[model samples]
Target: MVGAKMSNNLPCGRFEMRISESLQPFIRNGLKGCEKEGLRISREGSISLSPHPVQLGAALTHPNITTDYSEALLELITPALSDGSEMLGFLTNLHRYVCTNIDDELLLSASMPIGDLRSSAIPIARYGSSNIGRMKHIYRQGLSYRYGGCMQVIAGIHFNYSLPESFWLEYQDFTKQPGDPQSFRASAYMGTIRNLQRYGWLIPYLFGSSPAVSKSFVDGRNSAYSNALEKFDETSYYKPFATSLRMSEIGYVNPVQASFRVSFNSLDEYIRDLSKATSIPYLDYERVGTKVGGKYRQLTTNLLQIENEYYTSVRPKQLTRPNERPLRALSNRGIQYIEIRSLDIDVFEPSGISIETTRFLEALSLLCLFHESPAHDIRQYDEVKHNALAVANKGRDPALKLLNKGQEVHLRTWALILCDQLQEICEALDNGNKARPYTQALHKQMEVIRHPELTSSAKMLATMRDQKLSVAELVLQKSREYTSHFQKTPLDNSVKRDFDLQVANSLEQLKRLNNASEIPFDEFLGNYFSKIPEPAKFPGIDRKASQVR
Candidate 1:
């Protein structure tokens, strides 16, 4: 067993290699267990100045499908799966299903939405008449009021992953950690999160696809690039060296969230801080008013309506019971998994994400788990946020610098260093004859670093330049092309049957919920909020029970 002192020094090249060699056997053993994953991808499209498709009723009622912020914005979710290929395949079939359903609308292929419409023209997503559905609908309305509906329409992919319990048990034994299996697993997951915060900037550097936006996206807002906006054609705006403008301040900036100091040290601290944010009222949001002209405009005047409202690059997550709050779920059971939220939808991929990208993310997650992660201070947190913004806006710039260990480092230089470490981790992950997809993915990223033009963002800009089309034009063209491709391709019979069943089941479930409610809507909301259980007196007990159930 490696001592704490020994593990602390394993962040460097030689030490990392030695540690990777030592952990290879355990890694292989862990891989033998079932590897599970969950994916949720969101995309926004226009409805030709008409109301959202009446055929696709209230987003709140759907299970596999839903809306993010705008009625036109569609979010497609895949149930958890162990295989990366299966996940992507399911997502593609979902695209096929949606393409067949919607009438006269194209999924916007770019991360940024078509910005030509008025804010009010973008309608908030509506759920049915049920109280829970109304809560979901009104929350989006609050989002539209707080952040412009246009910004909310910007779409991305979320990857939810959990290492099997067997892996953690083996890891605990290998590390000789002094705690129960549950506590060790929770600590490990938190460590992965902290490391991700430190290094996640590299993700956008390599995969960020939104380097430019239509001029209308920034028309009414006070933009830092307002002066630069005039240089492009009246139809488009861009940063010459940007990677993902979608992740920049222009996309989802919230000053109120910025002011709060949320800690990632432990589960208790996280739940406490997040809960406080939900309870504490903000003057700015209060001004928006919960009810306007007898119509509910927002959920509450709090900093956050719920835990899901707190936007970050990554989050610690736990599976919830039937109607359990996310915080309560986390409190009752420690962190079950973590969600990676920084990925932009790659325009070139019909699924919005590629198989290589997903494999690389899994590799990164493993790297975070295997490496040493020190507790971070608020200053470190702020630095990570700054680094993310810098990479999002100016990563491709030759002169860009990012902070590492309180010292300035060239972005490319730091990225290459991390890639080297990922290379080592990939070797550990690649068991003989099992395949080296992780290594292949890491190599691809290394090539992107070597050739800046190979990045998705750069390719997007180049295509626009070569084709002489605007951002909106290019995205719409691709969206149409992909729509045609999906429509022409037939789903596998088994896959088709499963999808049919899921849709049918989701509809039946919605009907059941609608009919089962016996209480008033307001009373339901009151009970829901009031019944949030306090942090469990015993942490590991409910977690084990949850696993059994």
Candidate 2:
């Protein structure tokens, strides 16, 4: 127990390394403002439903979490989303909600528990227990089991929805204006500290050297990877939230996809919790787990099998042996997990996002968790990322080929097949009673591939070349839009000032952290792996260091 840590109440548990007493107000106000922003997404800035329906699965969420962005609609909003005195409650509630998202669930049936799925007490280090926040006493708690250096996970409502300029303008007129890069950091847990300089809606966050136990999972020394950015770049869940790197420099960085994966304590409890949180129905498992007694066994009642007959032997070598694609896996790990990512603040809108998007995400996650299997082994991750990069750079190119079963296939053809599968899955979801919006949303993407204008990469390139904008310049554009929206929201002077001040503080802190230097890479990862998750506290948790370079 000397080196180990657990939840707050545990004698050796770790609380957020920072003190909560100093800035409770900021957390609360931020949470309150987060409510009801969902309308800005799923329903707005979106196309009509697909007639045939499509199932996007975990590729995107079906639930409209954007509304959860608005203080008016979220359970955790009042305290954290506040534009006024509601600050302390705001931060606490905000943290609780995020944890709940990771822990709780709502089933498809009407019956569900009010409490979030009972969660195993997790680590309290939001950014990993560094004792950064100064106002309260920080405690060392229990650390994660498999993953080491578990940062308190940061989760947000990712809605696959958008709104029109007209709608955003109206909301801004009535809301507040405060898009100070600093203030948002009050609740945001990210490593890329420099990117804050650019208030652009789109950001490129870097990943630190992710020396994972699974070598198959990490991509080290990427031409795209940034070192200066790594100071602020978190390799795990904290990466996507913020960055110190300039997006102008790193052409395309995958949004941080950080998540704290937990194997359930009990199936009944897990089922009850997710059912309410998601407002979905759950049926009995057809079979559970891959081998006997595995965590996935709970899912036994419901099985989604991809028949074995489908095999591919023909394709161009380049497409077949994707330098970055995963080799297909034979074992069914059955351990189901989800990643929480893809959160973009809708700078133009009042809520920064909306509700419909959250629900859509919810729907999408269930579809994927219950449906898709990793096409291959963990070793295939490199290819996965490589394919992603190719798409980001040349998604619209018809000649592009991607690896498929040791064969090359037209990227367009692959996309269409994936898209077609989505439609089929959506039709089968809940026995086809209702279709998922993500199916239709795929069209939004197809439209972009057909015409480059809609892709983020395309938009980014166009803006940089045509407008001659630097990263900061583009960020400023987004900031103005968001600030204008916030300012219009009715609020008192004190609240606005406080919010602005918080933003300023965050920015200062971020810049300072980025500017600071560190030890060598070998030493940095050495100290990092020491904290790898173990069942019982490994004696190594007692080790300390100055900082990594």
Candidate 3:
């Protein structure tokens, strides 16, 4: 799918004009979904050491609510919906149901948790006795040993989306491409992923909510990052003009995979490289040992215990069947969706996201999909990483400069240009609707870009400084406020009943999985890694009927 190199400049007006009339309506039908993660905190505002509440259902089997890296980290997922408002409504109900179940515990309202945490203090999430469940638990254990548990506990929102097949068909024809529809669609999605890598920094700058943290977050770490952070107060650390510390090096960014290059040039290249990383052993992890003293310390001594361990701001996703490997699913099928992983869990919004944020992201996804994308090289890849860190650390700096096509450009200048391009996409997304919600969403983000203080990180800092509250204090208060709000407006009876039924069903499913499984863990692990599929081959779309209209 690698094509001729194109200039980084976006062909906004020309691209909009050239898109076929039939394709415009499909823009409004793109599917949107969200996965939001929040830490369960005690009433005193420290990370809760409690296990996942049983009333909410089994964390391993629940469809909507589950644990992420930590037993206390609640990850709530929403089903894909065409309407952003509906998707958010589902997410809201999930939160309300969860709040009703967990007695007295507040959902932490910030991306970065507040408190002093040693790696030993963070609890690894547990699954039951099933082989699959055990694999999940051991994988997290691997993460703790490899990256330390502190990094694993930080939470954020993942926006998942896919354009309608009608849109893809029109887009493929519009581009005069000749390939299998599935192949072309996956290739197009890869192009979008590549563009996302190039421009994804914008998300953190606009929506980033974590700029400061409890000093205890990095209490004893002796690294360059310690010097980078300024003391906000006796209890906190912050960067004066930072956007999202969560997206920065101190967050989920992994230094171990720095030398590993996973290509986005093509689906085959991406699969090949990622698969190789899983097989190649890293000396540091080998020293940690996969199994030590009759206990599994980690999954493999490989650079990546699994593909999920390779943290990135964006990922191409395919739906996986039960017991199927994610890589195998992608190889057998094709790209199903793209996950936007840079979004911070918004502190002010009870749902950790807003309709405005959702609409803006949808428009941004469209822009990435429609834009002409060139394949990435090592130099471009480095620039993307450098730009991401710059925005994460100092995005609100008026003089912040980012590398665009190897030339330095002011952050504000680049942002304005990107917003201008997004305007057309937003308009198309708002077609057939008089409200123009998508356009409004884009305009709101533009205002944030113009007024740096309007960014979430700035607002959070302002609140902290004005009141002289510690990071923990501010978030704890917000958590209490939001939890109260949700409690006041409980879920509708039908919704409540549905959630309750799901909880019962999930527990039953987990029990069955635990009791029915008989395979030895060693054989299960062997079968899993050995099933990694070879690179796929796809035929071109029949060219006889294809014509450039």
Candidate 4:
């Protein structure tokens, strides 16, 4: 029989043109995760700095990842961006937090108890970091390469450690200025980072890991070395998607540069205290650590060669599937918090992310929560994990089908509607752009998604093909810009002093990292579990009550 045509069947929800009144608090303050600041060097000498994947994760983890922007973000910096120096300064400040404030252990924890393990329980991760479970241990192992061989080097630091809300809000105002280069568009919290001077090494530029280096596991299945987990429109609905780190493999999400903060805990708690979450997926903290061995690093999994007990750790799988005929959409059974995993950090844009884009994400999360999640009869997070990969990497390709509403659906159509839903979210975030940084960024993205000329990944690959620039070169170019920009932002006397102090601190940390030939992994574990050592329960949820249309 001929396959029936898809009707776009976009799921409807109780949504609005503007962010609902209830989510104001969440839009302003619910999620928190992790962020990283790295420098990428490109061959062409054109530099770009990412607003740390960890930071993006951190931003998504918290509902309030969007902070209040100042007219200055709209005013001072947008204009300064033309100068290149100011734009660089602004990004630097944002990167600095990832450099200085991120907790190493939390990041390490993100990957511990590797494989489909972390998903087995409810976890609370610090902003854009990892759950307090085995994931912490896993990341530490990844750091062992050059980071002193001990996970201890990568643990505990809090969100407000260096950059506080006041700092975030300092440049939050961005709309007072009018016009494109002349007028204000939307404000951003990244201004502080963007305008900072003398801060080299604050750029988060690490791209996807090598295919061979990221897996670790006894099961070769977990270590499959293909970027096969993404959905690009393929016939096989449940293709496994995961990378083999040097030691283990955890469940893989699509295209890598995505984010989500989740837990296996109670629905009420997840909902009530989501504002307190701090862990993020897909973000890596910049420690004085290095990736060593012929072993490559995976997306969320970090490593540790500690105490001679090689361990793989990371959050448990979020998606699972039992069958392919019907799409097993979002799950909930006390699956209280919604995972926001579709965002990509736009490198070319200021703030690396934008107010508009974030606002849309904020809206989507709300929509998912307020309305009902669609359903079909499929179970098994492990399978769903593989299905997710099919959706990501193979999404644009033909032959792939996604189950929607108990009926077969083309991945492309689903993706378009998904993007449309995202559009609705962006439009709802902030009618005036004040409260919709996520949405604002999304609207801009909507334009990009539609325009062939602005295809980021495609453009990047094409540039590489045309110019013959190595990925390394493109990364370095990004690094150099951040390096130079930080070299010039004017800092106040106090900040200058603080900056100097931080430099001293960084040097000290670097020294420690350098001196260490090898530290035992056991000690690393000892120190890690000593705090917040209790794991949360996450039994297989029935989720029947949570199903939507």
Candidate 5:
């Protein structure tokens, strides 16, 4: 089926006539099988204030496990895998491993953390005596001062994905482009990223789960959403039509990053903009100061402490060696993968995410890649940002309207059109398999749109309203339920041993890093910042000149 369509006229004839002719077979072969995926799932849970049995130190040294911002918050990561089932299985085992180790703690199943606790009560993650470790801990301290620690505890999942190198090679061969392989691949990935920015609002509409939060989460803050105050009944604060308060202005939204103009046009533009932001000092952050009372408050007083500080819904990424900066890695090598950072943890799934959701996200990414992506100006970028904010706050409202090509369109109408397009991609992905998981997942999203009450956020809100429970109370109840389930169903003895080994090995690795340091901590910090190469001098053919329109 995909083979027949591959021969059809390429949209807008983006490729040369001869190149387009060669692409049919390549597209057909590429669409025939499952693509591999890399996933990183992060979840945060508060330790019981009365019985804090686990130390944050344990999370710092663990490889597969770690804390995000607070000692009470735990994050589990799974290695990249071709099989979604295998990935979920690994995540489950990691959760089980953590559960077994924590004597009297529970991993929160909800996206929002416990709301009753004060910001000062949450401990930042500490990574021993190493300079790098201290840098990480201090970065969190800066985040705490910048955005209150309560907000930092909100958890979510990151899905990292890349088409196989073989796929890119096939694409390059089909297009007959004249550039280095790595540069071509990076440009191709950037095209997909542009499309994602244009149409990413649909994501929160479909999967966003944090419709409400405990009243304490908004306490003393100037909130723009009047629904919270009007709807509050001395327990939960929420908007009736909200999808994810966690993704909205009330959550991780930083005013400082709101106007950041990082471009997706090419690798150089992206690196240049990000590099400039990191080097440019901000008066607000300067007021906070890098150090207070001889203690490091942050790594720097720049608009961004580092490239990772630019909080976007998606990012182009390359894995780095120890002590290597992320932007430096990209400047030297190119994008290895793209990270989807907007997904909220689905409370219904014990693994924080389900295989079905993973499949849908994979399908969405492929759609983004194959679509006709155009270069976007700052106006379009702002439009995309507005759409995402609207969906996060008022997505469930049937009358919600979003900007599409500068025209107002009903949210449901726009979403349904996207879902239909996604179904076509799902068919290509399913290959010849009868049990089409991708198509099923798309259909499920359609159902959620048709009946907004069926969305996860809506369901959570309903439960809270009916039970007269606060967000903290509901999440705590769910946490205990999941913890008990994990306790009863322990991992296989071999799996348990493997995790124990990983824990031991990670500790040893940390010790080695600490002992091997030769440079003074202050000197190491200066050298690291000073050595960040300018983007124009980045090692790659200047592919920006020949970028696709």
Candidate 6:
């Protein structure tokens, strides 16, 4: 194991006054995992009309592979591992396996999918006739209705991480005020989630790569922010200093979700508010109707069909049991890890991400955990949202300002402060190694902040300008390159055999799920909602959702 030296001053403020040497190994070796999503486009760069490849196994039962909102939008997940390199290698292998199985289709490398897409054209994923399968499909149907299918096709990556038990145990001992180990761990993760949101705008400014998008993203409809985007050739639209259009108002932001009031202040508050949203009826969704024409239009008329529908940049996560709700799992096991959902897929990488990105994210997770995180109220929450959109829309603009503690601060100034603190954390993560991979990752990102033109968003726009290529053309070219890159590198026989076995097992699992005896759809929904009992409140946590966002 790499050795980390003790440091007196870590720029970690009061929270990390003295991080123990025992915790250093866990910080350096945090478990990292990734969930990458990409659109499966035809060779001509249009959305693929074909169903998910049968060769890859049933989308319903596949542990590592599944469909997102669309039948053609593939999501690949990697198991959490201590080494970032191993995590990335596993992700690469998953990509190779998918490419080998899917014939004549390419995974679009860019986050903002470019195609002649229409709401009717994109196929919603099907998971067979089981009750649970039907529930999944119907929930997606609700999404398509609430937020158009066009927006659902915008793909990105999710970074999942958790500090090791050693770190948590040492941390619990350090804090000394915690009740139980699980409660302390959950509280610590909640703090991390809050900090992650507080400074998440930096994510887009540094790594966002979706400044330009296809004209068809709006599908011939007049967009409210049509004036915000300038024409990039006849076939595309773009924002001059935009970082991630995928994160901007044009992408994932929506009116219904904008009004969502879930809390990151505490696990109990989060579960209570989220559970209430899932149960309380929303008038707008009510019009869609739970069952219309004898078919389920959605799972419910509630503000959220389920917890997953409430979108955020980050989420406290717990692994759920079979047929268990995500909230129930968290209430049962505390936060097992956190899922960082704001990263845009780097078009330059064959696996949609890189080892540097993973290492950097792991370090960031630790920084958030160790840093002081104050509880947030509604005003602070709105500020967070405003800053996120500002950075997403115009992060590269020289005059861009973001809200910091209700005051406007230049984006670069705030970034520098964060990076300086991050450098110390990364140094400790490097553990006196000569390679300094973590520090190197932080340095590369610092360069992007110093020279905005070096950002992925800027590079994407520059590439388009230099080549005089439309967004579709440039992304399609990269799609072809990535397809060949993955296909040409054959998976090892052992790995190939393992994937084949998984495929077979997934198919069998789906069959069993579909054939198993089950209750009626209405009864299933009732039972599901009924199971979300009010969790025992944490010792000092405020239960009011109004106190939070």
Q: Best by TM-score, which number? A: 3
Q: Show where candidate 2 strays beyond 4 Å.
A: 1-337, 342-367, 370-379, 392-398, 424-440, 464-468, 491-549
Residue 427, model 3, lDDT: 73
lDDT of 2 by residue, 467-521 (tens): 8653323434543444333333434467445544543554455355445565543
**Candidate 6: minimum summed lDDT over ten consecutive residues — where?**
1-10
What is the alpha-carbon lDDT of model 4 when measured against the actual structure? 0.28
Deviation in Å, model 5, residue 66 alpha carbon: 1.5
| Per-candidate local distance difference test | 0.72, 0.25, 0.84, 0.28, 0.71, 0.84
Cα lDDT for residue 114, model 1? 73
User: lDDT per residue, candidate 3, 67-86, as tens digits?
Assistant: 99999999999999999899
- In candidate 1, stretches whose alpha carbon ends up further than 4 angstroms from where it belongs are 1-14, 18-45, 48-58, 220-230, 531-549
**Model 3 error, position 219 (Å):** 1.5
Worst 10 residues of 2 by lDDT: 106-115
Instruction: Give the least accurate 10-residue stretch of model 3, judged by summed lDDT.
Output: 540-549
Instruction: State the lDDT of candidate 4 residue by residue for 472-538, as single tens digits.
Output: 3433344344434433454456745654554455445434543555434444444443332222322
Q: In model 4, which runs have C-alpha deviations exceeding 4 angstroms? A: 1-34, 37-91, 94-139, 142-356, 373-384, 398-400, 419-428, 431-440, 451-453, 488-494, 501-549
- lDDT, model 2: 0.25
TM-score per prediction, in order, is 0.89, 0.34, 0.94, 0.43, 0.87, 0.93
Using lDDT as the yardstick, the better of models 2 and 6 is: 6
C-alpha positional error of residue 281 in candidate 3 after TM-score superposition, expressed in Å: 0.4
